[model samples]
Target: MIPQSALAIVALFASLVLLVMGNSSLGTIAALRLEIEGYEPGAIGIVLALTSLGFVLGSLFGIRIVQRVGHIRAFAVFAGIAAVAALSHPLHVSIPGWMLFRLVLGFCIAGLMLVTESWINSHATPQSRGSLLATYMVLFFLAASSGQFIVALGDPGMYGLFVIAAIFIILSLVPISLTRSTPPQMKRGKRLAFSVLWARSELGLGGAAVSGVVLGAFGIVGPVYGYEMGLTVEEIAVFMGISILAAMVVQWPMGYLSDYLPRRLVIVCVTGAAVGMALFTAAFGQRSSMHLYGGVALFYALAACIYPLSLALTHDMLAKHQIVPASSLLLLANGLGAVAGPAIGGAAITLLGPSGLFLFLAAALGLLLLLALHSFASERAPLVREQSHCVGIAPVSTAVIIDLDPRQESG
Candidate 1:
């Protein structure tokens, strides 16, 4: 038989693949269906923002829940709620109803992810940490990107798609729910101290929030952008899927490169590219051209890399105990951006029309790009000194990213 840790990793990866597939599919389906039902952009955006709110709340409160119950139990609870929540989408068609459903799923998913990450933390050895993190990143993006294509498999107008999503969620519970292994006890971090994080890594914290805006809007609103631009549902699915895949394709190379180069310069260069692509997207979004999708893919590839780079930088600056606090601060920044992105994206959609979504994103990323460049000039020596010896981290999210930090091995 495979070693227990190896089995756990495989199970978690497979389960996460199913969960993310269902989750990603649910988001696009909700967006497209809500639009088709004649919901306004502002209302749609609010519903989307509510999910981030729930996720933020979950991250804040979920540690205790995981501690009271073991990780597997927590996983089962969250998965059950999420599965039920997925099925509820088709049953209730009101804006408020969907918002509540999304909120619940978001909260559950956050806790679910925490449980998974803690489990992963225990399973990973120092020798395998870096490769494990990279694998996690790849699996996460691949599942999410592939899940977008699942939206194309069925009509969003009907119940079949929602049922399919629910099925995937339920199937995800199979492996771990049946396993006999003990779930890791939830590890508690030090109290969150945002002021310290900001003092130490302003660029990292600020960039994390900005990446949230960029990533949150793209993930939640990209399909809406495509729909309003007159793409067929299938075409929109492919557009979202392909764009995410482009990010997946680019991330390993970007991480490897950031290892050797200055993260700030890499961030600026990547964000600069994303800014150009966003401008391209804004200019050409409404047109029926394949080139627009190409622009989006490239834009997202660069855009997606920014957060991890910022995370790597943040990890380098903080001491061992300080790392978790910083991670919490980064998540707080991420949550703020996630909440802001949809509302801004929606307002832009309302005021400037569909292309306005990308326009707003361009503006957000543009500001962050400038911040990164300014940091290059103003905060050069510390980063330069640190870059020579800093360890890399792919902070996965606000709640559980530090587990993957290479520094954790020695700390």
Candidate 2:
């Protein structure tokens, strides 16, 4: 048998590749529709929102695949669907067709991500889970960042990007599919116990939704916004790359701090700071390249911290049995936010110009921060308390704006 450590290394590697590629593809698509294909901004927002809807729908129920078909097989099935959808870019289908395909791709990507996470969770002991989680997070950040950069390499009209996406999907299959390690048989169960998860912990669910909304807005609509403002593809890619890198660099301190502090307090502070930053940019930032760099950096730092803090907050109250459900609920919430984010943010920009993008983001964060305060007020337990558990970094690796759904993984 292959050593479990070696299997972990392989699985993590594959998962990272998929995540980076999967995450990056949305930006490319949005940019292409706006810059290359000359799509209407309103239509693009709806299309992207539709994709988020697909993700939300898939995540809510896709767990059935693991129980019925096994993780490896289910992963392959979704990977194949995503690969096909991604590779079909050459057709440059009509707006309606693109939306339909995006919807399908959304589900496929969600399944791929969920199963990969579950597999990693299965292999890791609590002793090593933190490190494992950290490693996964780092790789996810790198992959997501690198994927955005890939858009800079060629014109969207070329099939190279699609081919690149296909290669990533295939590459993602290598590590886990080839592993000698076999996870424990999945417990056959309902696809998703939505009501159960919601009743258990709404906080984690909300965190996930916020995470989805924040990132989804930036991921799907940021490139499109940049394009409308006269940024070339390369510059647009750089904007995303730099912003994501900022998010990655900030994660260590943010993640570390999350373990010790009340997650709710940290969330309110970071998200509130993000809202302030967005408002500042709307009122004072320049539209020039130099300004874009600074704006993206600021946005990236504050926006990136929200989901992690939310995850930490929700994780605090969860019982052991609740972790998986809670995580799923978080993801689901994020997915819904992701779905709504681009539509609202994109529409804001479409109606009021690019400054509206920041305005939309600022308002959303501000609202969440306020709601968080209300939640704290109603709580029976102290908002800040001694942490009962140590989330020591596992030897591993590894949000949104309104995440109100009581589902999906927060991190």
TM-score against truth, every candidate: 0.95, 0.85
Off by over 4 Å in 2: 1-5, 188-205, 259-262, 317-321, 376-385, 388-411
Model 1 over residues 255-364: C-alpha lDDT tens digits? 77887778788888888888999999888755646667888889888888887788778877777777767777787788878878887887788788888998899999
lDDT of every model, 2 decimals: 0.80, 0.67
lDDT at residue 333 of model 1 (Cα atoms): 87
Candidate 1 stretches with Cα past 4 Å from truth are 383-385, 388-398
Model 1: weakest 10-residue lDDT segment is: 388-397
Per-residue error (Å), model 2, residue 115: 3.0
Clashes of each: 0, 46
Best by lDDT: 1
**Model 1 pairs whose backbones collide:** none
Total backbone collisions, model 2: 46
Give the number of the best model, judged by TM-score.
1
